[model samples]
Target: MGNLKGVALSLLFTSFVLHLPFAESDWFINYHIHVTNDLPLLKSPPNQPNLFLHCKSKNKDLGERGMVKGQDYTWDTKVNFLRTTLFFCKARWVGHKTRSFDAFVTDRDEMPCRHYHNSCMWSVRDDGIYFSKNNATWGNVYPW
Candidate 1:
């Protein structure tokens, strides 16, 4: 009985140690967006015309503001560790009226950024948006 108990405890300790690396490597997905002036819309109005990128998960808002035309903005937040959490990103412009574009939805499990250097890039265009692990080619298409 003493030998059996010792064997069980040893197995348990080995299992815990084997999982340490995965536990310590908890990674956060970094999200990035580049908004371009496809259309020569005049600069935001003096009333502080609002143009920004909004990212939201189940319980957190990882949004950014003051997005200028032809500029890029990037931000990161803790990866959703709960039940399959759905997150979305959109470019919003608030002036006399409100307009949103290039809306996309993804979950941590489905985000390629998680596997590819923990980063993702998005290009916001008037027609739609495209995503890539690298910023060079627009491979994944997301509807506007």
Candidate 2:
């Protein structure tokens, strides 16, 4: 009985140590948008098409809003969901024209977004869209 008790205690201690919170900052994903061109809101004039940013994960909208030129917006993951989750962001304007980018919670080489970092920035330019991870410079983000 004493041997069994010691084994149980050892197992408990091992489990505690393994499950302890990581010393480094927790993994997080952030979505940022920097609007550079004319992006009129829905409430804007009649002739101009309304422009907006939309982000979603597994059919759930994280944050979506009409964007303005020179304005920026960010949305950070609130909780850590161990499994891989794909988050998508889109730049859309009225008349059905849209450009999108996808980022995975898990590190994926094929994905445009990087993992285990701070934040990602999306730059909406007149010519094309781009993204930057952490403090890295912006790189072109192709439509999905």
What are the models' TM-scores? 0.53, 0.55
Candidate 2 on 35-144: residue-level lDDT in tens?
33344344546444355777778757867776556566565552244535567777775654788766434343213433424455566655457666544576665532
Candidate 2 Cα outliers beyond 4 Å, as residue runs: 1-50, 78-83, 108-117, 134-136
Q: What TM-score would you give candidate 1 relative to the actual structure?
A: 0.53
The stretch of ten residues in a row with the least summed lDDT in candidate 2 is: 107-116
Looking at candidate 2, what is the lDDT of residue 3?
Answer: 100
Ten-residue region with minimum lDDT total, candidate 1: 96-105
Clashes of each: 0, 0
lDDT of 1 by residue, 24-130 (tens): 34544444433442322546453442456676665777666655556566655443444244556666654422334333234433356654565566665555556
TM-score of 2: 0.55
* Residue 33 displacement (Å), model 2: 7.7
Which parts of model 1 are misplaced by more than 4 Å? 1-50, 83-85, 93-111, 114-116
